[model samples]
Target: MKPVDEYFINQKEPYQSIMLYVRGLILNTLPEAEEKFSYKIPFYNCHNKPMVYLNILKGKDYVDVCFVQGILLEKKFPILRNDNKRKQVRSIQLKNLEDLDHENFIALLHEASHVLSHSKKAWFI
Candidate 1:
């Protein structure tokens, strides 16, 4: 695939809204996260690797926000959905602004931030 700038950069309307929504939430949570343009997508990298990635593939109807380490969250928070489609990583779908889960959504972002903070502070084993 070409660089994200060549692919997603051309998306218009709804696709941009959904992708931006997730992107805004991620930036709001980790204000200092470094943005990465890799694998034809936008990845939020912290502590050197990605914490989450937002990809808007060509022709796809919805943009995807992928938690790079979502498997751990699935194990820690059993209440987190464990649908068959979420076998590897986890994601919250947003059709519009209304699809935002607010409270739990913020919590997930915090959890990702916490994981990165700990990994950097020697708090991780």
Candidate 2:
């Protein structure tokens, strides 16, 4: 299996389920995304730009679905976290299935992909 595949397959119960679901949501929304392992986590690049990434947080309680150009989409969705000292990445933390907001998640994914594809700046860098 690919390293990224192994990463997800090795996760425990609810974390596994959450990661799988988020993976589906992202791929379904952006079919062109290329999935790979970067920083030992699952990273997706869509339209030749950094798109999204998924991973289980260190404590093992949640999975973080991170958007590369999160700062642009933050105002649109309140669920996105901008806590990191770096301002470029934003993410949604999922602790359980209940935390999955399908509508908002899909919308955010689409917007993130759009920004990655259209933005002239090197947002990924």
Candidate 3:
């Protein structure tokens, strides 16, 4: 994989911190995550399907966490951001890592893993 952005490496305050928090939260909960570079951004996948993708665009105030199967989990946990664009993917944008609700984030991640696992098992039936 190409080197992660020097800016991402050099990022110290909110950006790097946010990424680290999110990275740990994401990896710890998901059982099959493998790091891959997709579209020059950091992404994680399970059984070849994307689970999480993150990007820190230049001069941007937020870090975008994609790969959200928000619609699937919303019935149980309704805290995810809901956009009109589509129902499958939801995003959690953060200005700073502190702003994220860590416990809730992890809960959502666990729910995501469970949903995928169940869906994958059902695929063979």
TM for every model, in the order presented, reads 0.72, 0.90, 0.74
lDDT tens per residue, model 3, 62-83: 8877645666767776655554
Minimal lDDT window, size 10, model 2: 116-125
lDDT of each: 0.66, 0.82, 0.68
Top-TM-score candidate index: 2
Residues 31-123, model 2: lDDT tens digits: 888888889899988887777888676654678888888878889887989755656888888889898889988888887878777887537
- lDDT for residue 3 in candidate 1, whole number 0-100: 62
- Give the lDDT of residue 76 in candidate 2: 87
Mark the regions of model 3 whose C-alpha exceeds 4 Å error after superposition: 1-7, 10-13, 57-60, 120-125
Off by over 4 Å in 1: 1-9, 57-60, 75-88, 119-125
Q: How close is candidate 3 to the true structure, as a TM-score?
A: 0.74
Worst 10 residues of 1 by lDDT: 116-125
The root-mean-square deviation over C-alpha atoms between each candidate and the true structure, in angstroms, is 4.7, 1.7, 4.1
- What local lDDT score does residue 5 receive in model 3, on the 0 to 100 scale? 47
Better of 1 and 3 by TM-score: 3
Better of 2 and 3 by lDDT: 2
